[model samples]
Target: MNAEIIGIGSELLLGQIVNTDAQFISEQLSTLGIDVFWHTVVGDNRKRIMEALRLAADRSDIIITTGGLGPTMDDLSKETMAEFLGMELEIHEPSLNRIQSYFTTMGREMTDNNKKQALFPKEAIVLKNDNGTAPGAIIEKNDRIHIILPGPPSELQPMFVNEVKPYLAGKTVDEIYSRVLRIFGVGESSVEAKIKDLLQKQSNPTIAPLAGAGEVKMRITAKAASRQEAEKMIVPVQKDIESRLGNAVYGYDDDPMEMIVIKSLREKEMYLALAESCTGGHVTDLITNIPGASDVLLESCVTYSNEAKVKRLGVSEDTLKKYGAVSSQTAYEMAEGIRKISGADIGAAITGIAGPGGATRQKPVGLIYLSLSSYGGTETKELHLSGNRLRIKEAAALHLLNWLRLSLE
Candidate 1:
């Protein structure tokens, strides 16, 4: 079924609040094989809201609305919905008692205006609000379904999960499922070029590629009667994409580079150490963010200067003088030094010039050098990145983690 989301709020238009409800609802609806066609954002004005509702009813089979459900004078969702659908607003006695009891337990006065929250369209299904005072409603009228939810995400998310999901599940036959494949080291254009054929001839399972900071995400969505069947349909397509992309595909859904590195280390019973320069403690911070990292992360040293590199990671002054700090030789020395000092199974180092300031005639900005030292051998890579200081640092950290993940695999 096709759906449309109408957000009723002035705060959203003014940029005072973000409408995360539409995104959440769209994702949830897609899983039930429902397609979200349009997202409409209207102010608290009644005329615009009514217009949006009328347009949505004509085009969409289902209309979901958020916001404007409260005790305040600005709240107008229920009144508009009841008028448009030609339903009488009746007091839901159970919801009224719940609101009254809530005020009684809190030792607060229950004003007459608070009773407004308990009113719903006659014959409409009441959606209980466990988290707040405003309850939601679901009304099916004249071949269209209208669901009204509160603005607060805390209330809307739970009410949808507990009440709306099951109601919608009964109305649909097929289910939609999606898997995300995370890639690094390759630009978005390159990855898209490799999968252009899949995108052109797509039907059942669709491929969508999104690019972000130093990484790309490929979302593979399929529809079937069951989750297992949907996933089975996605298997061959995913395999073909992976085969074309090769090692550039680092991780999967919700698995960033750091998590992949930590999982590999823990699974292989290995320990790792870090020596960072231009990235400061960013690499170390990313690694330690994952749980159970302490067992595998032995030590992390930030050797910013020549003295610190010599004192902490044992980089010789001669190498720094000959090839400078951001060099392959220095990177290799730093990696080997950290591994020897911490006695870890693996040692990774990142030394770069990520900046708007630090640049000589030979070494320009965004020149990065990364190295990894393990039992097998030591490998080094150089990167000439572009962007602000923070972006360059983020890229360097991602590169270091990707290298570690590739080596472990």
Candidate 2:
């Protein structure tokens, strides 16, 4: 079934709050095999809400709305929906009792206007809100279903999970499942070119490529009678894409580079040390952000200057003098030095000129050298990237992490 999510609040339009409810609802609906075609955000104004409802009802089989179910005067969602659907609003006695009991249990006085939370359309099915005072409703008219949910995620999420999901599950026959393949070291264009044929002839399982910060995400979605069946359909397509992309496809679904790297390090029972230059401690920071980092990360040093590199990471002064700090020789020395000093199983280093400045006659900005040292040997890579300083730094960090992940594998 096709669905449209309408976020009803002036705060969303005013940028006071993000419309995360729409994202959550869309994800939930997608798993139920409901296609979310549109997301409409309307202010608390009645006319605009009515117009949005009209548009959604015309094109969508299911319309889900969030927000404006509160005690204040501006809370107009229920009243507007009732008026638009030409239904009479009546107090649901059980809901009214529950709201009163909630206030009483909290040692707060219940005002008369708070009773407004219990008001629902006569023909509607009331949804219990255990987390908040605003009770939601589901209205069915002329083959269209309107689901009204609270604005607060804490209240809305539980209500939907407990009350709405089963209701929708009974109506849907097919289930949709998706997997996101994360790729690094390859540009979005290259990824698209590699998968162009699959995209052109896509049908049952659709492939969508989304470019992220310093990475690309390929989301493959499939629909079947069950989630397992849907995932089974995606496996061959995913393998085809992976075979074409090769090692550039790093991880799957919600796996970030750092998480995968740390997990790999832990699995191999290897400890790592890092020596960072132009990226400062960003690579280290990313590694430490993952849980259980201490199990695998021994230490990290931010050797920003030539003096620091020589003093801290034991880089040879003669090498720095001959090839400069951003060279492959210095990177290899730094990686080996850190590994030896920390007694780690592996060492990684990144030296680069990530800049709006610091470009010389021979060396340009975004010139990066990455090195990894292990018992196997030491390896180095040269990269010429382009972007602002922050982007270059982030991209450099991502590249190093991907290298570490591949090495571990």
Candidate 3:
């Protein structure tokens, strides 16, 4: 069934608060095979809310609203909805009792205005709020269903999960399942080009490509009676995409590049050390953020200055003078030196000129060199990236981590 979410609060339009409720409800509805066609945000004004309700009723089978269920004078969702639906607002005694009990348990006095929260449309299914005073409701008129939920996430989330999900599940016949494939070292356009044929011939499952800061993601979605059947339908498509993309596709879903690298290191029983320049220990920070990182990471040194490079990482002063700090030779020496000094199985180094300054005629800003030193051999890569200093640093760190991930494979 097609649904529309109406976020009723002036704070959303004024940018005072983010409408995270829409995102949460959309995701939950997707699992029930309900397509969210639109999201409408209106202020607490009764006229605007009534207009939004009229529009939602015309185009959507189910209308879910959040916010404006409170004791304040401006709370208007229930009143506006009742007026539009030609229904009478009546006191739900059970809900009133719950609200009174909540205030009593908290050792607070119940005001008369708080009773406004217990009012609902006649013949509406009252949804109990365990966390707050505002009780929600489900009103069915004609063929359209209107679900009113509280604004606070703490109250809305539980009410939806405990009350609304079961109600919607009974009406749905199919489930929508999605899987995300994470890709690095490839742009969004290139990924789309590789999967052009799959996109053209897609039927049951759909393929969508989304680009992030330094990575691309392909989401595969399928609809079936059961999740197992959906998985069966998605396997061949996933195999095709993986075969085409090869190793550029690093991990899946929520696996970050550093997590993948740490996992690979743990599996191979290898320890690593890092020597960072313009990245300023960002790569090391990413690695340490993951749990169990101590098992794989031996040491990390931020050798920013030429003196530190030479003294801490054992990078040769002669190499720095001859090839410059951002050169491949300096990167190689730094990696070899760190591996030797820390006694790690592998050492990775990043040297870059990620700045609005420090550019020569030949070496411009965003020029980066990455090197890896291992027992087998030493490997280095040069990248010419373009962006602000922060973007350049992030992209350079991601590239170095991806290189390490591929080497471990």
Candidate 4:
């Protein structure tokens, strides 16, 4: 069924609040094999909301709305929907009891306006909101389904997941499941070219590439009778793409490079230290975000200046004088120095000119030197990236993690 999401609030139109409900609801609907056609946002005015409802009803089979279910004057969603659907608002006894109990439990007196939250359309399916006083409802009229939910995500998310998901799942037969392969160190065009055959020939399970900052993600989605069956269908396609992309494919789904590196380090019983120059300890931040990283991560030293590099990481003064700070020689020295100081099993370092500024005749902007020192030996790589300063820094940090991931392998 085709659906449309309507967000009701003057605050949303005024940019006072964000409409995160539409995104969450659309994802859930796609999983249930429902297509969302449009997202409409309307202010709290009754006329505008009714117009949006009329437009949605004329085109979409399913209309889901968030906001306007509160006790205040501008909260008009439930009443407007009732008026549009030619239904009377009836008090739900259970909802009223729950609201009264909430007030009683909090040791507060129930105001008369709070009664509005307990009212639902006659014959509508009441959606219980355990997180708030606003009880949502689903109304079916003239072959159109209108599901009204609370505005606050804290209330809407759980109500939709616990109550709305099951209800919508029952209407749909097929389930849509997707698996994403996250890749780094390859441009979107290169990754797409490698999997060009898979893209053209895909029918049941479709391959779509999503590109971001310094990474490409291939999402393979399949629809089947069951989630297990859908996942089973995705396995062969996933394997084919992974085989084509090889080590450029770092992790799958939601696993970031940092998570993969930390897991790998833990498995190998290895400890690591970082000497960051341009990335400014971002690599260390990402690693420490994972719990229990203290056992594997020894320390992070940010040597932003040439003097700091010489003093803190023991980078050679002669190397900096001859080769400059952004050179591979300095990166190697920094890694080895950190390894010696921290006594870690592995040491990684990043030095670069992440610039809108600092570009020499030989050393240009986005020229990054990454180094790793291990029991085997010290290795260094030179990279020339292109982007703004923040993007260059982010890319450099991600490259450092990817290098760690490869080393752990």
Candidate 5:
């Protein structure tokens, strides 16, 4: 079935808040074999919302609206939708009881205006909101379905998954599954060049490539009667692609490179330390951000200054004085130093000229050196990434971690 997501908030159109609900809804719908053709975001105005609703209803089988479900004057989603559908708004007794019980449990006074949350379109299916006071609802008219959810993601997400999903699941046919292979150290153009034939001939299972700062993600989606069938369909293609470019594909299906590196290190009984310069410790930040990383991550040295490199990671003054900080020699020494000092099984370093400044004629900005030091291996590679300071920093981090993933394997 075709669906449309309509996010009702001025903040979305004004770019104050991103419309994450549409993204969540689109992912969920794809799993249920529903194609979302349009994503509409309308302000908290009655006329505009009504126009959006009317447009969505005319073309889409299922219309999902998120936001503006609050107890305020600007919260006009339910009231406007009721008016548009020529339906009356009535207070749901169970919802009213839930709200009252909640306020009483907190020992707080329930104002009259709070009762507005209990109002729903007449004869609508009440969507219980366990996380918030604003309960959502589902209504069907003229063979078209309307699902209105609370504005807060905490409320809308759970209500959609637990209460609303089952209702919608029964009405759909077939199942769809998608797997994404995230590749680093490879340009999107090169990846496309290698897989252009497969992409061009795509039919039941669609292949799409998405390019970002310094990496490309290839998504393969298939439709089948069950998820197992879809996964089975993907296995052969996944194997073929892996065989061709196993060195570049770091992780699969929403797995970040840092997570893969961490997990691989755990499997190998290895610990890691980082000496970051261009990435400004973002590599350490990503690794430490994961839960239980303390078990494997010993220490991280952000030696942005030449003095810090010399003192913290034990880089020799002569090496820095000769080859400079952004050189591969400095990166190698930094990795070896951090590994020895921290007693970690592995040390990774990223030293680069990530800049709007500080680049020579031979070494331009975005020139990065990633080094890995391990018992059986010592490797260093250079990368030239593009973008502003933040992008260069982020890309440099991802590149170093992905290279660590390769070394671990």
Candidate 6:
């Protein structure tokens, strides 16, 4: 079924609050073979809401709304939608009782305006809200379906998943499934050029490309009468694409590069330590972002200054004086020293002259050295990354983990 998600709040339009509810609903609806063609955000204005309802009803089979179910004067979603649909608003007795009992159990006096939460369209099915006071609704009018959910993500997501999804399941005629394969080493254009032939002739499963940072994501979606058929249709296509790309595909879905490194480290029972100069502990931040990483991460030292490098990570004074702190020898020494001091299986260091500040004719800005040291060998790689300091730092950090993931594997 074709669908549209409407977020009802002025805060969304002002950028004061994000309408994450629409994104969450769209993803859930897509899994049920529902195509979400539009996402509309409207303020708490009766005229605008009526216009949105008219537009959604004309094009979409299902119209889902989130927000403006609170007990306040600005909450006008129910009143406006009732008038637009030409449906009378009636008190849903069960929803009223749920709201009333909640206030009584909390030992708070219930105001008359709070009863507004129980108001629903006549003959509408009430969807129970276990986490909040607002009771959601699902009204089926002829060929169209209208759903109203709470605005809070905690309340809205679970209510939709548990109560509303089952109600829509019986009416669905097909099921759609999608998987995203994330690849590194290849640009988005290059990846698309390699698979343009298959993408052009696509019918059952649609292929789309999205680029971010240093990775490209290829989303493959298939629709069918049954879940098994939908998955079966995409499997061959996924395998064929993987065979063409080989080892460049780093992850699937939403996996991060640090998670890949942590997985390999824990599997091999190896410990890692890092010394940061240019990246300013960003590499450590990425590694520690994963849960249960304390088991493998030994220590991380941020030696931003020459004195800090010499004092903390034991960079030799002569090396600092001769080749400078951003040189390959200093990076090699930093990595080796950290690994030796922390007694870790591996040590990595990032040191560079990140733009706009320190630049010379000999060693210009954006020149970075990434070094890795282990019991077997020690190696350093140089990169000249462009952009501002923060950008160069983030790129260097990600590049460090990606290299480690590939090398350790």
lDDT per residue (tens digit) for residues 1-409 in model 2: 9999999999999999999999999988989999999999999999999999999989999999999999999999999999989999999999999999999999999999999999998899999999889999999998999999999999999999999989999999999999999999899999999999999999989999999999999999999999999999999999999999999999998889999999999888999999999999999999999889999999999999999998998999999999999899999999999999999999999999998898896789999999999988999999999999999999999999988988888
lDDT of 1 by residue, 1-409 (tens): 9999999999999999999999999999989999999999999988888999999999999999999999988899888988888888989999999999889888999999989999998789999998888999999999889999999999999999999999999999889999999999888999989999999999989999999888999999999999899999999999999999999988888888999999999999999999999999999999999988998999999999999999999899999999999899999999999999999999999998998998987888999999999988888999999999999999989988988898888
Every candidate's CA RMSD: 2.7, 3.0, 3.1, 2.6, 1.8, 2.3
Score residue 408 of candidate 6 by CA lDDT: 85
lDDT of 5 by residue, 1-409 (tens): 8999999999888999888889998999899988999999999999999999999988999999999888888999999988878899999999999999988988998999889999997779998888878999999998989999987787888888998888989999888899999998778888888888888898978888999656789889999998999999988888777777768988888778888888988888889988998888788888888887887899998999999999998999999999999999999999999999999999889899988999998889999999999887678998888889999899889878877777777
Better of 5 and 6 by TM-score: 5
Candidate 2 is scored at a TM of 0.88
Tens-place lDDT digits, model 3, residues 22-64: 9999988988889999999999999999999999999999999
Tens-digit per-residue lDDT, 65-170, candidate 4:
9999999888999999999999999899999999999899899999999999998876899988888899999988898889999999999999999988899888
Model 6: lDDT equals 0.90
Q: Model 5, residue 383: what's the lDDT?
A: 87
Give the Cα lDDT of each candidate. Answer: 0.93, 0.95, 0.94, 0.93, 0.89, 0.90
Report the number of the highest-TM-score candidate. Answer: 5
Candidate 6 colliding pairs: none
TM-score of 5: 0.95
Candidate 4's TM-score: 0.90
Clashes of 4: 0
Native-to-model Cα distance after best TM-score fit, residue 286 in candidate 2, in Å: 2.4
Candidate 5 ranges with C-alpha deviation above 4 Å: 101-109
Quote the positional error of residue 284 for candidate 6 in Å: 2.3
Scored by lDDT, model 2 comes in at 0.95
Q: Candidate 5, 332: how far from true, in Å?
A: 2.0
